[model samples]
Target: MVNVGLGHAELSSTHSNGRVQEERRNEGVVTSWCIAKPSTDDESLNHNIDYSCRQKGVDCRPIQPGGSCFNPDSIISHASFAMNLFYKSAGKNYWNCHFNGTGLIVTQNPSWGTCKYPA
Candidate 1:
């Protein structure tokens, strides 16, 4: 989700079932944050991601087979998502994006093709 203005309404577009739908509403204020990792696999990153998922009880079902985030599924992809969730839950602060060297913070939205990141 993107905030159009300060205390202003924003339009959200959702693509589902071959149709594009849009709506206006105020859900929550969003700040720009992106957690990215290298293509190379790292054990520490995996460990942090796993511990985060279990400890926080994050709902990762959306990344499962037949789920919304299932496409382009990979360890790195899912880990980035989980890390982002952790940051968002913690109030979208710079510190929240720090996952003990597991991620890098970027100003970009980090939303992939058809994969909407929490704003």
Candidate 2:
């Protein structure tokens, strides 16, 4: 199921047995990740990556070739990973995730396959 609000959307899935399973965004947990807004262009994302990766404690190794988070190989994916690392390393502040208004703080886990995004 998908719930589309004014400026946000929520998604859920159903198992083969026909049971609806909602996304794990609730349950009294407060986890956040910094991701590039979908409307952000590649040039902006690249700029974000450059800025975030240069910060101290922002380890961008996982997005390098042969790294766990390297499979997607998309500017958005890499930018999101790098941005999140910078955000997490910078104390998870709202401003830390703000990459010139191109970043967004999301509660959903963007992890895919073996690439686990840090919370």
Candidate 3:
């Protein structure tokens, strides 16, 4: 299961309606961190972003964790800016973006050393 944002919100598998389903709940204030691992293709980027948004309880479409298109250089830069803003507003470290394999990964509560950005 992926921990999206604050609230204990998780995407868990459920067995209902004769098929497996995804259940979402507002648990309140995401405490655990989340990671998005994408494949090495642009087509998968959208799925990755969707996964992240679902995990975070946010409206992130056309982009889900493990998807490809989600790794735009401009998007990464913008994400950094948003992370900085979140840190400043909340007075707590929040989001981070990094390149791994042929894709990008977004993580929370990530170690500073894990960042691939230039110093």
- Highest lDDT scorer: 2
Candidate topping TM-score: 2
lDDT of 2 by residue, 7-86 (tens): 12221242332222233554785777778887888899999999999999988999899998886787788888899999
Note the Cα lDDT for every prediction shown: 0.55, 0.74, 0.30
Rank by lDDT, highest first.
2, 1, 3
Taking every candidate in turn, the Cα RMSD to the unseen true structure, in Å, is 8.6, 5.8, 14.9
lDDT (tens digit, per residue) of candidate 1 on 1-119: 44221011112354433332333244663355435455435576576567556645466666578766555566666666667777766777787766765566554455555566675
Residue pairs in clash, model 2:
none
Off by over 4 Å in 2: 1-29
What clash count goes with each model? 0, 0, 24
* TM-score of each model, in listed order: 0.63, 0.77, 0.22
- Write down the RMSD of candidate 1 (Cα, Å): 8.6
lDDT of 3 by residue, 5-105 (tens): 21121123433223212222337544322333322343344343333344432433222343221233333322332333223333334333332332322
In terms of lDDT, model 1 sits at 0.55
